[model samples]
Structures are given as structure tokens and as C-alpha cells.
Target: MSLPPRRPRLPLRARWSAGLATAFALALATAAPAAGGKARAAEPPYEARLAPYYGQHLDWHPCGKPAPRPAAGRAAAARERGFSCAEVRVPLDYADPGGAEVRLSVARKPANGPGERLGSLLLNPGGPGGSAVDFLTGYAGEHYPEAVRARYDLVGVDPRGVGHSAPVHCLDGPAMDRWAATDLTPDDAAETAALRRSFHGFADACRSRTGELLGHVSTAEAARDLDLVRAVLGERRLDYVGASYGTYLGAAYAELFPRRVGRMVLDGAMDPSISSRRLNLDQTAGFETAFRAFLRDCARHEDCPLPAAHPAANRALAAFLHALDRAPLRTGDSTRKLTEAQATTGILAALYTEAAWPALRRALAAARSGDKDGTMLLSMSDAYYERGADGHYSPLMAANAAVNCLDAPAAFTGPAAVRAALPDFEKASPVFGRALAWTALTCADWPHRATGTPHRVTAPGAPPIVVVGTTRDPATPYRWARSLAAQLTSGHLLTYDGDGHTAYNRGSTCVDTALTTYLLTGTPPTPHTTCH
Candidate 1:
């Protein structure tokens, strides 16, 4: 029930096949030369007001040093791989273009081409808070398919109120540590009051530190920012690859600028038609499905720590977490103990991908041991929270809440509503239901009122857009993808009948080949295409 981070910093070993070569060849044959033209000119009086912003130039330079340690090295490596960074200025409020402004941090890896360049392909690893800049310079810039890289200038923009782009600040490290350890599921009225206090304190800190900017970080604004980015990059149309929550951002952009959309691949899609409450419940069920899959896999191995039977395994894991709530386990760090919340976070982290299941197994086994070493699980929890070794936390969670809270009405207005919803939530996922139901209380005390509402995005005139879904994605459910694909006027659903979050580069050659072809040649796979 921790808000799912879009792209976890987990090892994603790439697997390629001979089919990719064929796809690449076909792509090259159809690919067109990159145009140096500006975006289609804006229309009318509103366009006149926004002219200066759209007309400004980008001053690209070697990427800046990242705050995190090893990241400095990654930035250098990205520079070596033809990556550069820049800042694009946009209005803090699009409605008031002449008002305060924020600068978007952007990183670009120019096309590595012996073939025709298609244009800039924007990438966003969604969080509503994820740093697309960090995602590019750290992993995707170097790891995306060489075929796609050969013809496209890969660009990543940290949307306003995220990363280096005038980020939203709430609790500092120590405060965040305390907040993260707060009991998520209340056992009684006193505990419930404590949880309310935690949410209120977080909201208060955000209002005090983030100021007016906190109210403006909605996905709708972020989508407008994406348009500004596209224009500044001199693209006639936007070509993009967005995963998880990024799909919603892309959908918004398409709805707003349908004709400006080009080749877009939305992997791990979110259904824009659903309310925040529905999204929470659906995601809760998704994670439960993923957890069960992990348990089944774990049961096959001799080192598995839980009972082989599914129901027994679920009960056993639940008991372990509940026991931790009563008496936390010792992590190697003397300063920190693994509470039930942290353990749940750690378990959810592994459920993002099956690759992390063995690590989860090891961590659980260690915690069950006499020594009660909780180091591994604690480490994973820290990673999910984007906490550093130096005990500093990123603004990821703060910005995540800011954007989400502003995008929709509170899932539940107060504890009473949450209590009323518990029965339904618990039925959705016995292990995660209660905590996730409490998570709905997060936006109840937000300083800003909701500015957007749930609605289906048709993007009526947009070009063919591919929507990828994993059968067992833990964060965004496959059904959401189906719903989104059905909603989008031009959507093509490409299904990966496998486990894990997104499908494109996880391991499926079929998924990768289809996606690569679409990006390179503007051809969508057949509708409702299923790939194993």
C-alpha cells in the first residue's frame, strides 16, 4: 500500500532475439529523416500569450553532477554516451503565462545513427514524481534498444515540481523516517488519531515548504508542460514512451493536443476513467495478485520459507507482518528497526518484478531466523522511498502526494469513510487491504482542493498509440490497460501474458519487437495483440 514507484532501481537484465533484427530492418526501411521544423504553430489569442515560452531556445551542456554519490559517475557515463542536459522555462501556471515560472530539467541522448533520424522520443518513467532525468542518465539512456536509439534522440524531462525542477519539499530526512515508520493500519481509536496526525503533519509541512507551487502540480499541468517541452525541442509532433502513471500524463497530452501526437507507447497503462478511490482499490487487488504469484513461485523452491499451500502461505506472511507490528525486528543498523510498515513496503518492492522474489525470500527467511536480521528488507524499503545512504530522502514522495492529491478528490474524507470502506478493501487483498484503505486518507488534509476530476481520455484524432499491459503487473493492473485501450480512440492494446510491471524491455522479445517497430515506423501492432 505504499504508493508504487514507477521505475524501481532494480536490475533489469535485457534479453534479445533474432526477431529484433528483422524489426530493425523494417523500421529502417520506413523511418523518415528528422525534421528541423518547429512544432505546429499555436492558434489565436491564447497562442499569442504563450509565444515567448514556445519561442525560447535551449542551451544544452554536459549533464550536471547528481546529488547521490554513484549517480555522478552515471552522469559522466551518460555524457560519454552523447547525453546532454538543459533547462526549459515554462509558466508556473499555464492560465497565467506571465506569472511565476519554473524551469524543467531535461536530459537528451542524441540519436546514434547510420540511418535516418525520426525525431526526439520523450521518455517518462512515471511516479507523478519519478525523475525522468535520473531515469534517462542512469539507466534508460544506455539500456533502451539500440534500434530505437539509432534513429531517435531520447529525451527525458523532469516535470515541474519534481527532481531539479522546483521540487515540492515536505518533511526532511529525520521527519520522513519517522513518518515512514508511522502505523498505517490503526488497531484502535488512539492509533487512528496518530495516523490522522501523521497525515496532517505531512500536509502542513508541504503547505509551509512548497507554498503556491503545491497547488499547481496536477497531471493536467504536467501534460501542458510536456507540450512546452515538445515545442522547445523543435518537434512537429511528440513521440513518447511512458510507463505506469506516465500513461495518464500521455493520455492527457493526447486529449489536449491530439494532432501533435506521433508514435507513443504507453506501457503499464492507467485507466483515466476511474476515480482515485477506484484506482486505489484496483491497485490493491493488483498487488495481491502479484504477491500470490510470488508465493507460488517461492513454494517451488526448497529455500522457500512459507507453507506451500496458497491460503496457508498468505496467512503465515500476514501473521509475520502483524507480529512485527507488535514487536519490530532488529535490522543490522542499530538506529533502525524493521516495523510492519517497512516490511510491507519491502515486500511490495519485490512484487514489482519476479526478479526480486529471491531477494524477498532471503530477506523473509533472515527475519524469521533467531538473529532476526532485517537488513535486506530495510534496504529494499529505503530504495522504494528513494532514501539515500546518508539518510537523506528525495522529494519523490512529497511530489507524488502533491500531484496525486491535486489531481482528484480525496479517496476518503476522513477515518469514518476509511472504516466504512475496510470491508470491501479487505476483501480485495487481505494482506494489503487495510493499509491501502488508510492510504486513501492521505489527501484528506491536503492544503489544496482538487483541480481535476476522473474522465475518460479519447484523444479522438491522435495517431495509433500502443498500450502495453502485463498480465500480473503489481502497480497498474492489466484490466486498467484493457479499459484504457478501449477508451482511447486510436489505442492498440499489446498484452504481455507474463508477470512483472511493464512489458517492453522486461524480457519478452515479442513485446520489444512490436514496441520497437511502432516507435521507429509509426505502425501499431494488431489491436488486442497478445505476446507471451
Candidate 2:
């Protein structure tokens, strides 16, 4: 979700009709017959349901269902860390309670200085695929303000199809390389054809490789699984913190579990109401806004890649990218070419942080001089979907594509559609429009049809939820934060006039203070709050 490679709209125009036959056949096989009629045969079981109903949208309460305690063998491990790990079985499709099941990995860090520790505070890091357990053990367990950490158990569960929970793998390293290197903006018929082929190839590869789990990995199901974790952890209500995509998950949980209200914080919130196309386009503009800020700083520095004396560094930067679009330069590496796509990705990587600005200036300077090494590193940063040595990739990029495509509609069908929309895109982000416009084309041929549409996330009767917005956030956009805050009755907007992806846990006294206070005392700051 970060802008590193800062990187979706319609139901009819959005969907691909190529796989209609298979989808219909599957649908018929799974469609439930009318109840109590002579031909009221039961439709296929939940196993046949392809639409995912997992994650933040369902009512999930603690099942009070006892589970097998961790093996006595792990006693020493628990004694040392004051935590234990367990597993819970949840339906692959929540709508079909009697269907096949999947195991969810759950971890519990019991409270340290508690007076009968309050309920568990579940945590999710926001990728439809980020690892929650990793977030907890890595940061939430130790870095969360002491007051909140001291009174409640921190529970982390990697949502279905993410991290350790039966992860989905779609491509090998070489195959992924080809996918990532695919040309984004096709200028003519031949290139357009190539773009379509690449799109289809990506989708087909995902289907042939990881089709089974694609239908089971919705956000709604993940929410229900969380509820089961809540019950197993013996918490009466869920106390939690979710960031980025995690905020969407939390809001989804509130919509489904208003009665089981508890303390919850959704930092850097997303508005579910935005269409895929709109989301991508808006995000493109957001990155442009952030890039301008970076350029402004660069214009003042002596080492600025685009010289400040020129008084047109930003324009020059844009021209350099355009020139690269026509002719890619070679890096020292024989295998790597600094194509426009790679250069655009590098620019996006810099957009994520002020700390990255200097590096970006250096990289841009290097690229201007026909050396692509700096740009290569920036592309690498955006492609951080995984960490592997020898330039290998984990299944994350594939999985990321899988989850995102299934959850939402495609934004553009081909280069022609994108070309038609170029003016609008340019209006949004003259700096990065074409790259982002091309990026939106990836989902054009996704195999699955989404079950829901973008809609406002409002969970009435829920406790106060704090929504954090960075004034110049490159990824989620500040306006999205503002809109999200306005959408929720319980939402309190906390604005950080800064640059970067998210505000909290980064540097900012105001953000840290406000969030820490709310997480600890369950009291939100006043609405329209600003922290510079």
C-alpha cells in the first residue's frame, strides 16, 4: 500500500467477460435451490462458493469455544516470553458455515502487569496480506505505549491467505521478473496487444497456480476469524489497532460487530466508497502532491539533481522521465535496463519519505547522466513485496495482485482505455500519471468477480475510533483520511502536517501523543484536530 512503487472501478465495464462460461458453470453448481420445494435440492456447499466473504465485514464474537492448549512442551517458551501460540479453524466461506475450513495462526502476548488483564487487542498491519503476528511481536508487543500494553493481551493473527496461513504462491522468480518488467503504457496497436497479453498472462498464471485459495481470501472472512481469536483469547470485546489497509479491516469489523464494541484505532484509514479507478487515479495525484514537496526541498539544496538555479527542476525531472519513456538507459548490470517504468517507480519510492529525498536527488542526478544504478535501487524499494537474496522474489507480489484483484474491480481494460483517460490522469498527476495509469491496468483480467462494491464504512453504536491523516501522505492521501473521518460517527480526525505514508510510529510528537493518549485512556481528541 506504500507509494514505494506507489501504486483500481466499475461492475460491468470493470469486469472481464472472457471467463464467463467457467464462472457461470461454477455458479450454477454452487447456487442454492429454493427451500422446501419438490426440486428444492441443496446447491453446492460452501466449498463451491467462489466469492470470498472473509475479513472486516462480518459479526465475529468470541466463540467461547475452548481450544487445545499449547503443547506442554512449549511451557518453557511461554514462561520466557509470557506468550503462547495456538490455532483456530474457521470456515473458508463465512456464509456457508457447513463448508470446508481453514486454520488461522494466532499468537497471544499476555499482559505483564495486569489486574486481571482486559480483553485482547487484535492488531493488523494493513496489507490485505500484511502479517499481523509479525506486527505484534515486532512492534505492537514492545513499542505500544506502556499503559495500553500493560493492561491488555496483544493478539496477532495472520489473516487467511497471508503470511503463515496457507499462503498463496503464483509465480517463480523469473516469471515474476517478466511480470514486473511488462510495459505499462502501450502507445499503439502492437504495444496494446502486448499489454493485453501480459495482463492475461498474469491472471492466467494466478488462476492456474493459486486458483483454489483465491475464492477464500476475502476481508469479511478474515474479520470472522479475528472474532474466533477474540473468543479463544477469552476477551469479552475486541480492543485493537489497525493501520493503512488495516484501518479498512477495523471499520469492516465495526460494521459487523457493533454490539461487541470495545476500544479500536484505525490509523491512516481508507474509504471503502471509492471505486478502483478513482482510487488509483486519486492516489496518483496524492503522490504528485508529495513529489512536489520533495522537489521544493530539492530546489533549495546545493546538490539538487535538477539544479535550483534553473528554476525549473520539477519540469526538467518530468522531461527526463518522458525521455526515458522513449529510450531506456542501461545500468552497469547487463540484465537491468532503466526503463521509464523503473524510473517512475524510483520517483515513487522517494515520494514516501523526506529522508529519501536526498537519495532521490542523487538517483535522479545519476539517471540524468545516463547511469541507471540509482534508479534500479529505487525500483527495488518499490518491489519490496518480498525479501530474498540473489534478486529472487517471494510469492508476495503474486499474492498481493491476487487479493487486490479479487477484492475490487479492474480500473482499465487496455492501453486504449488508459489512453482515453490520459488527460484526466495527467490533470491529477502530471508527474506520475502515465505510470500509475499503466499500473491500474494490471487488474484488467483478474479471474474473480468481486462480491461487493465500494461503499462508506460506518459502524454505528461503536466506540470512538481515531483516524490519523498525514497532510501530505503519498500513499493513502490526506483527503481520504479526512473523508474517512467524516464517514464514521465515532471517528475523530487527527491531522499531521507532514510527509510520508502514515503518521503514527513515525516521528511526530503530536501524532504519537494523541494516539498514545487515546489508546491508553479510550478518549479521542476533538474533531478536526491538527498536529504539525
Q: Which has the greatest TM-score?
A: 1
Model 2 CA RMSD to the hidden true structure, in angstroms = 10.4
Model 1 Cα lDDT, one tens digit per residue, 1-532: 2464475332343311111100100000000101001112235687689999999999999885564332454677777767899999999987799999988899998998879999999998877778788778766777788899889999999888988788999998999998888888889999999989999999999999999899888877888888889999999999999887778778878878889999999898888777767878887888889989998999899889888888898798899999989999898889999998888877877777777788779999999888888888888788777777788877878878888777777788989998999998889899888888887788888898877777777888899988988899878889989998988899999999999888877678999999999888888998668998
Any runs in candidate 2 off by more than 4 Å, and if so which? 1-84, 114-116, 307-311, 370-379
Worst 10 residues of 1 by lDDT: 22-31
Q: Which stretches of candidate 1 lie over 4 Å from their true place?
A: 8-10, 13-43, 65-73
Q: Estimate the lDDT of model 1.
A: 0.79
lDDT of each: 0.79, 0.62
Kindly report which residue pairs in candidate 1 clash with one another. none
